[model samples]
Structures are given as C-alpha cells and as structure tokens.
Target: MDIPRSFTIRESTHRIHNPLDDAKLAVLGRALRPAPGWSVLDLACGSGEMLCTWARDHGTTGTGVDLSATFLASARARAAELGVADRVEFVHADASGHVADEPVDVAACVGATWIGDGVPGTVELLRRSLRPGGLLLIGHPFWRLDPPDQAAVEGSHATGRDDFLPLPDLLAQFGALGCDVVEMVLADQDSWDRYVAAQWLNTRRWLDENPEDELAPVLRAELTDAPVRYARYQREYLGWGVFALMDR
Candidate 1:
C-alpha cells in the first residue's frame, strides 16, 4: 500500500522525486502550455509538485494519486503553500490501476511507470483517464550510452542491458504505440548529480542521527558506494526525460 521505507527515506526531501529540477519542470509546463481550467491527473505523484505548480502557473485543476502518506502530506502542504489547495487534490492509493472518474486534459505517470509494469502498459493505463486529444506525459530513462559489461549495467541499477532502449528507439516506440511524441524535457548530468547526491546527503544525515537504527547499516553501505557507482555508470549511461504524447 506504500513505498519501501528505504526509498521513502532517501527521497524524503525531494519535491519532484526524479532527476528533474524546478527549472526543468517549469520548462515542461511552458512547453505544454495547458489551457486555463484544464484538468490534470498525475499517477504516482510524489509531493504533487507537478500538479501543484502547474495549477498555479496555468490556472489548471488537478488530482494526484500516490501511495506514500509522507509524500501526500508534503503534496498537500505544497498545494496550500502555492495557494492552489482548492485547485488540486491528492489521494493516497496505488496508481497502477487508477482511472479518473472524469477524463482529464493531461494524464501523467512520471518516473513511476512500474505502476503499470512498463512504458506500454503505463501508457495504456494513463490513456484510460485521458480525454480525447489530451496529453500523456511519461517519464522514463533511456540508455544514453550502451553499457560495455554487466558491471556497468549493474552499476546503473539496471538488471540487464535491455532494461532501457536507446533514445531513438524509445521515440520510435511511442510511434509504434500509436502516439505522437510532441514534446520532451530531458535531464542532464547536472540534474542527475542534484538528484543522486541529495539522496546521499539525506542518507548520511539520517545515519548520523540514527546510528543505532536497524536501517543505518543498509543506508550506510549505500551512501558509501552510491557516488562512485553513479559517477562510473549511471551518469554516463542513463538519460531520463518526460515525453508528452498524443494519440495519433
């Protein structure tokens, strides 16, 4: 019913929960330029940043679904902080099978497509809640560079080489799925550093404060190795982006 404790702890301070930063997220909002009063549905909406921010920026209304109570609290707080509380709502639930009671102008599953298994299935799920001509925003990683070996693949946190497709292949996949790739915002090395390094800091700070906690040892090991692993493998091989698609 909720995310793992480790993941919750690692991204405790994250607003977006992906490699995207505020500026990039703004760029995405600008790119989409959703009409005023549009309705958005975000699945696995961590902290509800996208919905809250877009509601503020575009005068849109939104609903966010997530499993993490901690994140939902943050999301609600963010909505209040942004003065969009009335425009956005957050529900604590599994997003995998969630379908909006009313069709939405935008349906998104950012960085959590595992909810519906993978890209294709996630798209199908999102489409179920999308109005005709509405946008579908899918955030996922692609292989920026082919891994040379299993060590590199594992370092990138992918179980195998085929876990991600090359960027071109990924775009082609959307076409094959009968969708048009209309717009995208990609994360660069700097954003990746921001996302990954923040987790290290969070883990380290938690370990320092809770040295006696049972999870300390596990996080301690992760913090010790994450920097090297990210620098060597993930930074070079993985490229993540949120792609806006429309059925063709």
Candidate 2:
C-alpha cells in the first residue's frame, strides 16, 4: 500500500515532513543523546530524515517504516547519501501495527500519531517496541491559542476544536499515559512558515511543469489559498513539537 499521490506530490521536496528545520532536528538528536550503536525505530518515518541523520551524527542504527513508497525510496537514498545505508533500513509498510521485532533504545512516532488512533493509543503503540526506561519520541501539534470558534478550527485544518489539545494539556497527556516528559523542541512561527510555505512553492512548480495532469487543478487551488490560510490560521493557532518521554 501507498500514500495518496496528491499527498506525496505536495511534499515531494520536503526532507523532514514536519515543522522542524535542519538545525532544530540536529538539536533534537543531540538532546536525545543516543549513544553510538543505540537502536531506534521510527514509525511513519517520512523521508527517513530522522533515522538517516541520527545514523550519521550519533552512529545510531534504526529502521524506518512508512506507507509511501516514494518516501521510502527517498529515505533509502538518503541513507546511502549520508553513508548510513548499513545502519538504517526503510520499509514500505503500514506503521499502525508495526512494532519492532526487538525492543529498541528509542521508539518514535513523529507527526503521525493517527497511526495508533490518537495520543494515548500512539504512546501505547510506541511503548510496545521500547526497552524498559527507553525513550519514546512523539511529534504532535497543540493549540497555541484557543480558537475563537468553529470557523477558526477549520481554518487551522482541524475538523473541530477537540481535534487538538492546548500545549499544557498535551504535556499532561504524556503523564496520563504513565510517561514522563523529559525533553521537547518546539516549532516557532518561522518553522511553521518554512514547512507550510515551502509546500506552496513545490505545488506551484509541479503545477507549472504538469499543467495537463489531472491533479494540476487541485495543486493550483491549494497553491492559491494555502499561504493565506497558513499565515492567518495555522501560524497563529498551532504549535508543533517533538517531545521525549520516558516510562515512569
């Protein structure tokens, strides 16, 4: 199985699918402090950036699983490019129920918690592959400010107000799941701009090159409205971060 073509088309140029830039991603790898030879499992590992980069920088080994064949190909190439092909592997598989064959030092489900239904379920899923006291990394979005109404929620790309919790409540969720929040790196408005604004350019470029393609209209519409929607709604209301948690 594979992700929708439209989804990949929109993010074809993204190395890291979330709001994290390269510097912030490096900061996260350092904060986690995974020793050389430590093992990691990254579920829904888009483009395999986290695994490949950590394999390069920290000398860690890992497996990345995703449903997107296109992304998996990019991930594999990234591993080779970083000279970590021997240390990391990318599998084109559904991450929802894919646990590591053996316990790992770090288990992560970044920015795709829906694979396990929601935060609690996703944490539980990650824990299944984590060694005792091992770290679990969850990337998620929280409400930066409470939305004014339903329209604001939709504008932020959420179906409803309940789709996401406030930042404090999100941290509390880790506690509720019996995990201690150990470290976190948040994305500011600039990071959000980098992530969302770049998609518009990618879409626009693709639309220009493939104007006759059936998806061109969709891309054109998205390019036309995404920037304003992101600037007005998502940038103001949504904050995203990757949180490191340890079992309590």
Task: Mark the 10 consecutive residues where model 2 has the least summed lDDT.
Answer: 222-231
**Which tens-of-lDDT digit does each residue in 106-163 have in candidate 2?**
9999899999999999999999999998999999999999999887799898999999
Off by over 4 Å in 2: none
RMSD of each: 0.6, 0.7
TM-score of 2: 0.98
Which candidate leads the pack in lDDT? 1
**Colliding residue pairs in candidate 1:** none
Residues 90-160 of candidate 1: C-alpha lDDT, one tens digit per residue: 99999989999999999999999899899999999999999999999999999999999999999988999
Per-residue lDDT of 200 in model 1: 89
Which numbered prediction scores highest in TM-score against the true structure?
A: 1
